[model samples]
Each structure stands twice: as structure tokens, then as C-alpha cells.
Target: MSKDNAPATLPPVKRRNAELVMLGVALAVTVSAFGASGLALDGSLPVGMFGYGIGFIAITIGTHVALRFIAPYADPLILPLAVFLTGLGLAMVWRLNQGDGDHAGAGMQLIWAAVGMLLCLGVLFFLKEPRVLQRYPYLFALAAIVLMMLPILPVIGIERFGARRWIGFGGFTLQPSEFAKIALVLFLSAYLVLKRDVLSLASRQIKVFGFRVFDVPRLRDMAPMVVAWMLAIMLLVVSTDLGTSLLMFGTFLAMIYVATQRSSWVIIGVSMFLGGATIAYFLFSHVQLRVMIWLNTFDPEIADNEGWQLVQGLYAMAEGGLLGTGLGAGRPDQNFAADSDLILVSFGEELGLAGLMVIVMAIFLLVERGLRVALASREMFVKLLATGLSFIFAFQVFVVLGGVTRLIPLTGMTTPLMSAGGSSIMASWIMIGLLLRLSDNARKPAPQAIQDEGATQVISR
Candidate 1:
């Protein structure tokens, strides 16, 4: 072909380069936080500051390299945002450890962070096709059920802080519900993709005076929602975990909305959840206490009892005011579950509202990118999966931060990437991995078409 007729060359995408640069910025912020916290706490740099910085850089850079190899077109900002949150969490956890006179919690968190990254890598490596998950929706649903139920078993089930949500095995206790959330999302995404048509179009039209008022799905088509409602109610009754029950059912509802584009499903889901929660509130003292605390957090009687955590967190944030007490200057250690349920509140106390907003914005961006991936994807299953994962991630953060800020009743949900639990960390990273994979598929260029003897072929696999 002549030079003028030759194909035009496009510049290579610099997505990986952008990711590397943002990772560096995130690393700098983390190191600075560690240094600042150490100086404020002990009048000297912590002995492990360099070690933590090096470990963080290593893990983040390593993950970036892996993405370049496997998912070069993935969203560049998500990894850096997550690293930023994890690093801040580490700084806070380590600072809190100073009050306890031990490094166990910080050390364990670092180890789990590494494991979470490895699991993320495993997802990218092994999950060559996200659609494969669609093949076994029932299995994923069953796995979610078993995981949620594990903590209720007689031999291993353990109750902590009035919630039976963890299973003890030997020395370590694991919150199986954290991972169950992902499994449930997978199942719902797959199932909804297949049933959306029926649920959306096969509805019974309710008309009055020859005008259609509303549409109701057939009773058979409502099976998924019914099962979800029952499962959520059972989870609340047995586990007393309002957060997980709300999260799972909420994610299911959101996926149903995305799949079917129907408002009635959401209305039904919300009504069922509210009714079930109201029943539980009257029947269970724990539920009643949570509601009362949320309603009257400053009431002296409730504040001294069930509302103590929320009250303390509110006071800390108030004390910090707009600028916070500067990293390690606050007494976050005085609050129970400060490293997990109240981590955001802890940040608000030390970093002030400004720093807290930065963290929240980072989370917002991560979720926005996930939804963008869903919008970009061509497949129904992939789109639903991305939407489900993103919604759950955002909702979990909202639930945790809301509880701490008294925007809602306190629940035992941990802030993802910013919490101090192995299960939560690992599950969060796995979700990130899935999001990266889906984003890669969404953003990567489609294969060029080819002409055969008498047919055309398009290569995607």
C-alpha cells in the first residue's frame, strides 16, 4: 500500500504510568501521616515507620506492576485510592497500638493487608473470565448461606459485643459474613441477569378506571426477592447483625433495580426490610437498644449504656473541631472498636473534618469508577456484577460512617480498607480485584474483525 493509504497509528495509552504516579503520591501521604503521628505521640519517630513505608510501597508498586501485566486498561485511580485508605488505616492502627503497649494489632493488620493484595492478585490471575461466575449462581448463593450460618454453629460460633457473627477456629476468629457479601453479590448478579426480562415485562398491570396505576411482578417472579427477605430476616434474628442483614438485602435490591429497571421491586424490598426490622425491634432487646441509642444518643441513661460508643465518637469529633488534634494527638484508644467500626470517626477526631472529607472523597471516587465500568461493559452479566459490587461497597461505607456519625443506628460494619479486621480487608481487596478485572474488560479495545471465505469472525476470547 502507498504511504498515504497506510493505516494510521494511535498513541499508546499511559494508564499504567498514571497509576504509578498516583501510587507514589499515595505512598508519600501515608509516610507523612506515619511520621506526623509518631512525632505527636512519642516526641520521636516510631521505630517501625521506615519498615511500614517500605512494606507499603512494595505492596502497592507490586500490585501496580501486576495490573500492567494483566489488566493494563483497568481504571488507574482505584488502586491508588484504596492504597491511600489502607495506609491511613495503618497509621491510625499503629498509633492506637501505642496506647496498648503492643504491636500485635498493627503487625497483624500489615500481614492481612499483604494477604489481601495476594488474594487480589489471585483473582486477576485465575479469573480469566468473569462470566464463569454466572454458571454457578446457585452454588454461590449456597456458599453465602453457609458462610453466614457458620457463626451460628454450636462448636465454633462466638458472640462478641452481643453479635454472633464470628466463628472461632483454634486461635483466630473469622467473620464469614464479610466474604459472604461478595458471594451473594455474585449470585444475585448472575441470577438477575437471567430473570430481568421476565421480572420487568411479565408483571401484572394494576389498572383503575381503565388507567394503569402500577405493575406487580407475578408471585413466581418474586421468588428471589422473597428468598432474600427471608434470609435477611433470619440473619437478623440469629446473628443480630443489622449491618450485614441490611447490606446483603440492600445489595440484592439494588441489583434487582439495575437488572429490571423497575421501581416496584425497590419499593417491595424496602417495605419488607422495614417491616422485618420493626418486628425485630419489638421482639429483640438488642434491636430495641440500637434504635433507642440512635434516637436518644445523648440521653444520660442510654449514653452510659448502649449509646456510649456513639457518644464518645461524637465528643471526639467535636473536640477535634475542623482541623482535628493532628494525627496521633487524639485519644482514639479510649473508644471501643475505634480501629474497626469507628475508624472513620477516629480519623475525623485526629484529621478533623477536612481530612475526613478527603478520605470520603477518595472512597467516592473509587465507587464512581466502579459504576463507570458498569456503564462501559457490553455484557448484561458483567454490567450487573459491577453495579452490585459498587453499590455494596458504597453502601457499606455509608452504613459504617453513618453509624459513627449518628446519622443512623450503630451497626457492626467495618469501613472497608480502613478497618482492622482480616476478613474485611481480604474481602474488600477481592472486590477490588473483581472491579479491576471488569473494568479491564470494559475499557480494553475490541478485537478487529476478520473476513473469512464467506463469513466474518470476531475474536474476543
Candidate 2:
């Protein structure tokens, strides 16, 4: 190769692989949707089939069209995966609404999905490059903090199920914490890139029996993390929202590790998190209640009250068995709070364990592809952005799954893309848009080298 010839080189294998992956996802999703509707309608395939078909096509087309404008070159697999998850969610929501016709959350969820798609397009159009975000770190951080605190404001904040985590606007409600997560991630990425070298530079060290222990971080270097930690703890203790706090803290820790590439940071971060959690557990009454409920979910006395949700969820999952009870046949809709946070359990009850596993696999594939994008990206900012987005996906999934399965204390976090909430849907789409943008940028040839070669060729000519 001549420099002039390189521009014409085709990435045939990569393009082919991308197309194959997209096709596979589309087929899998369509099959899953049909299975869910088939099972739910008792194999009659009349009432529920139309809903499944329309929902799948609408979401797939909407997501694909939006992604084309935002991140055309990014992994074509992610949009379909997201659409599949959304379709599964819609099916579960419709199944639930069949029993309680008064519940309008599913309807609202569909509207939110449309709105989220629009937001994804907006992000793609406005934020053409990750570097443009660097100019607004402070602004983004401040806005994020304000949003996190909005639910605590007088008169506007709504306290539901013991957590003051929602802000009611007119007839609708928004969870500011969801948006805050994205803002905080952007802030951390920008801050970390700017300070990575300074933070990585070794400061003073103390020798303790042949072991060297570094001194505490400088006040300036520790400021942002400390502030984030404080915000997280306050959200947990004051707002009684443990899931978002844990998520935010986990995300901050991941970014810190990425910035420094040091396992020591992980050790220190975990220790501090545990210390704060222990103190909060004892100090906050709601935290104590959650811990007690988690510890005693199986006990006969509390099983009907505090442990009712988890027990019901487990029953639903078990009832689902391998293939599920055939969608609408399951009685999870009879239970309280079956549509929102425990939506996954509803999925298991209706779609079966097989359906739930398919959803999980989709999420796992999406995350794995995101990690590959992160690995391929040459820019530090893009790498950090991808890493942060991956952490968000992983953390959200763990929290929701853990809550449903009783593996951890219930945190009341909505399932991403699947949960019936406006904030959750919008925030998720935005995160997906960012990941797509980063992937597109990663696939593009480096500007400096390409430009240099072009200049040299021109001189030779």
C-alpha cells in the first residue's frame, strides 16, 4: 500500500459481521415476541398478537431510525436488542393491564418510549463529539446535583412507598435521579481525563513493616469524588433511595478505576463505601427496615406485609417454570406493585424463565459489545464514556435483578428499557445514544494520521 490506495480499502468482513449480528437480533426478538404473545393468549394468537406485533415493529423502526441519525456506524446489534427488551416490557405491561384496567402506567410507558426516542435523536444531533461535553463538566455536575435534590424540595416532591424520590409536574412525575446518573457520568469522565496524570502521580508514602502505604489524596484531587460520595449517601439516607445511591457510587468507583488503572483504588473505594453504608444503615430508619425485610422475607410473620413483594415475585418466577405459564394466564397482575419495579417478575410469571433468560442474554450481549467498543476506541474520553455507560447498564441490571430475587435488599430501581417510567426510559436512550456515538467514532479512521498521509501524497503528486 500506497497512501492513496488506503482510503479505498473496504472493511468487508467487519461490515458483514455487523449485518449478520443485526439480522440475528431481529430474528430472535421477533421470535421472542411471538412466543410471549402465543403463551399469554393461551395459543389462541388473537388478542395479544396484534399488540406484540405493533409494539415490536414500532420500537424497532423507531430505534433504528433514531440510531441512524445519531450513531450510524455503531454496532447495529444494540438498537435491536434495546427494541427487543422494550417489546418484552410492553408485552408484560399489557398482560398486567389486562387485569387492572385502571392502571395507565403501560400506556404512559409507550408514550415515554416515543419521547425517549426523540431525546436520543436530539442527543445525536447536538452532541456530535464527546469532546464537546468537556466544556460543560461543572455545569453538568451542578445540574445533576440539583436534579438529584429536586425531589426533596418542598411541595413538589412526592414521597411514595417510604422514599421521597419523585418530582410531580402537572399530571406526570419524573425521577430526577435517573437523569442525574448520566450527568454525573459525564462529569466524572471529563474530570478524570483532565486529572488522570496528577492523580496517578505518586505522593507521599508511609512504610509499615516493609509495606508502603500512600498518604491520603490531596484535597483538590479528592474533591469531586468526595462530593459525589456525599450526594450518594444523602440520597440513600435522606431520600430513602438506596438503589440509585449504590448505582451512583458504583459508577463513580468504576470511573476512578478506569482513570487510574489501579486496583488499590478499588480496595479503597470498597472500604469507604462499606463504612458509609454501615453508618447509614444504623442511622436511617428506612435503611434498617429494608435490611430487616431482606433478612426476614421468608419468615412467616412478615411474609404477608414487608416480604409480600419478594415472596410474590419468587412465586411468579417459579410458576413461570422453564417456558412460563403462558403470558396472561399468570396471576401476577393480582399482586400489588407488579407493574413498575417488579416488572421482571411479571415477565417471568407470564413469559416463563426462558423468556426472562432471553432478555438477560440480550442485555449481556449489549454490554459485551459496548466493552468491545471501549477497547477499540483510541481516545481516552471515548474509552471512559463507553466504560461508564457499560457500568450503568450492568449496575442497573444487578440492582433490579437482586431486588426481585432477594439476593440483596430491595432498592426499588426500575429495570432499564423495560421499566414503565419516563425518566428511566429517557435516560436509558440517552446513554445508548452516547455509546453509539463512541462506537461510531471508534470505527472511523484517525484524523491526524489520515490527514498527514493525504498531505504527503499531495506533495509527491
Candidate 3:
């Protein structure tokens, strides 16, 4: 073929290069900070820096490669944003580890990030079509439920930090809740796509002040939400992991509303959630304790016990003020929980409000881009998937931040990507990969046959 007739295939390569360049700059900044902080190094300079930096770069590149397979038409900004968040999290975790005398989590986190990148690529390479997931929503939901409940399964369940939410395996621990969220999202999206029309149907109404309020949904119609709510409640009451429970419930509610587009559903959901929470607050001792602690974090009476973590987190945030105490020079090590649930507080302390705002804005941008992908999607399944994933991101952020800031009762939820948890890092990357796949699909021009079939289906419906 002539030079003019040669295939135009450099766009993707160019885009990937741009993403790599951005990541490289971020990595360089992070490495520079680590070196300048005068923190004790775990290993030789070459080995430590190379291991950490290469691991991050690999994860970022692997995520983008996975997106090419799973969500080939996703927004360009999504992958880069994910890389930034992951890198920021790693930086903060490393900094905190230096002070806390536990360099293992940061190093282990790097390893997990690499493993997670592989998982992302595997999902993308194997699960090439979104429709393939629709065939097994029931099975997936059941598996997800089992995985979620594993942490509380009689003798097998392991308790940590006063919560039975971990499954121990040979010297390591795994949080099934993380995988459960992903499975639930997929199952919910599939279920919603199948029942979208039925859910949109209004069964009955109650007239009040010239306004007709919808009556309660039939048992069959409410089964999904009922089961989901029960699962969430079980996680809260049994495992005492209120953060994950609340986040899962919120994500479910968001997906249902998006799926059915019913204002009544939202109202009913809120009512049910509050009613259930109130009941649980009185019924469960743990729930009551959290509420009390949240209400009195500053009170000296409870500040030493139930309110300790919150108080410390608040202090960290306040001490940092607007510009932070610098990356490696904060008091995050003053509390034991600083590395997990209170990591954001630590980030806010060392990086200041400005740094925290940057992190928050990055998350918001990623989620906003996801919603855009959902809106642009041509298929119901793809739209629901995108929206569901975005809700997961948004809900997780809200729950974690709210818990740290005492906007709500603390639930011990780990911040996504930023928290020092293997499960979270893996699940987050998987979600980003899925979102990129959906966005890619959204960006692609619809084949003529699909357009024609969609038109026919709409007309017939």
C-alpha cells in the first residue's frame, strides 16, 4: 500500500504514551518527596525505589491495557485519574508507614497493586463482552452473598479491631466485602436491566392533598432491595462493619433509582433506611456506641475510648490547617488506626486541605466521567453498569469521608485506593477497568445492524 493508504493506527499508541508521561511525572514527584523526607529506608536505595516506582508504573499501565479490552471505548481521563489516585494513596501510605514503624503494608500494597493489575488485565482479556455477565446474575448474586457472609461464618470468621470482617488464609487476610461489592454491582445491573420496564410500571397510588403517592411495591418487585437491605444489615449487625454496610445500601439505592427513575423509590428507600437504622441503633449495642461516640467526639468523658480515633483524626486535620504539615512530618502515628480508616485524616494532616481537595476533586472527576459514560451508552446493560460503578465510587467516598469527619457515625470503611488494604486496591482497579470498557463502548459508533435492531425493539416494546 502507498504511504497515504497505510493504516492510521497511531492514535491509541499516542494516547497511551500521554498517559504514561503523566504517570511518570507523578511518580517522579512522589519519589523525590520520599527521598527528601529523611525517612528510614527499608532496603537499599536502588531496590526500594525501583520496587515501589516500578510497581506503580506497572499498575497504571496494566490498568490502561485492561481498559482496552474490557471497556475499550471509555473516557481517556478515567485511567489517568485512577493512576493519580492510586499513586497518591501509595505516597500517603508510604509516608504513614515511615512514622508508624510498619514498612510492610506499603511494600505489600505495592505487591498487591501489581497483582491487582494482573487481575484487571485477566478480566479484560477474558470477559470481552458485557453481555456475557448477564447470563449469571443469580449465580453471581449468590456467590457475592456468600463471599460477603464469609467473614462472619462461625469458626472461620476472624475478628479484628472489634469487628468480625476478615477471612484469614495462611498468614494473610482477605476482606470478602470488597469482592462482594463488585459482584453485587454486576448482579444488580443485570437484574435491573432485565426488570427495568416492569419496575417502571406503577402498580397503585395513594391520593393525599391532591398528590398521588405510590403504594408499596409488590413483594416480587421489592425482592432485590429487600435482600440487599438484609445483607447490608447483616453486615452491620453481625460483622459490625457499618461502613461497608452503609456504603452497599447507598449504592444499591442509587442503582435502583437510576434503573427505574422513580422518585417514589427514593422516598421509600430513604424512609426504610432511616427506619431500619433507628431500629438497629436501639437493637444493636455497637450501633448505639458508634452514634454516641460520633455525638461526643470532643467530650472528654468518651474521648479516651470510643471517641479516640475520631478525636485524633480531627486533631490531625485541624493541625494541618490549610497547607498541611508536609508529607512526612505529621502526627498520624499517634493513633493505631491511622493507617486504615483514618488514613484520609492523615493525608489531610500532612498534605493539608489543599491536598485533600485535590484528591477529592480527582475522585469527583472520575465519577463524573463515569456518569457521562453511562449517559452516552447506547445499551441498557452498559448504562446500568456504568452508573452502578459510578455509584460505588461516589458512595464509598461519601461513607469514608463522612466517617472520618464525623458527618455520620464512624463505620470503619477504608477509603478506596487511598486506604492501606489489599482488597480495596484490587477492587478499585477492577472497577476502573470495567468503567473504561463501558466508556469505550459508549464512544464507539453503533453498527448499523445494532441500530436497526434497537429501533425495532423500541417500536415493538
- Most TM-score-accurate candidate: 1
Task: Tell me which of candidates 1 and 2 scores higher on TM-score.
Answer: 1
Q: Can you tell me which runs of candidate 3 are displaced by over 4 Å?
A: 1-14, 39-47, 62-73, 206-208, 212-220, 446-461
Candidate 1 global TM-score: 0.93
- Give a tens-digit lDDT track for model 3, residues 1-461: 79998657432222555665766776676676555444533333423556687767766666666555555555778767777777777777776777767778789878777776677666666666777788888987898888888988776789987788789878878899888998988898899889988877776776799887765565568777677778877788898888888878888888888988787777777777788888999999888898999888888889988788888888889999999987767777786677777877887888899988988998999899999989987788888888888988888889889888888887777777777889888988788768766766667655784586578689999
* Model 2 agreement with the true structure over 1-461: per-residue lDDT tens digits: 78876766554122434644664566466546555554655655545456546655666565665555556577666666776676667666766776776446556677777777678777777877878887777888898899999999988999998899899978888899999999888888888888898776545555689787544555566666667678888888889998998999999998888888765566666777788888998887889989888988889877888888788888879888998877677788876678778888887877788878878888888898788888988878778878888889989989989988888898789888887778888899888778777777777656686687679789999
Question: lDDT per residue, candidate 1, 352-429, as tens digits?
Answer: 999899998999889899999999899999999999889988899889888887787888999989899999999999
Arrange candidates by TM-score, highest first: which order? 1, 3, 2
Runs off by more than 4 Å, candidate 2 = 1-43, 46-52, 55-59, 62-70, 103-105, 204-220, 446-461
- The model with the greatest lDDT is 1
Whichever of 1 and 3 has more TM-score, that candidate is: 1
Backbone N/Cα/C clashes per model: 0, 3, 8
State how far residue 329 of model 2 sits from its true place (Å). Answer: 2.6
**How much lDDT does each candidate structure score?**
0.88, 0.77, 0.78
Q: Looking at candidate 2, what is the lDDT of residue 382?
A: 76
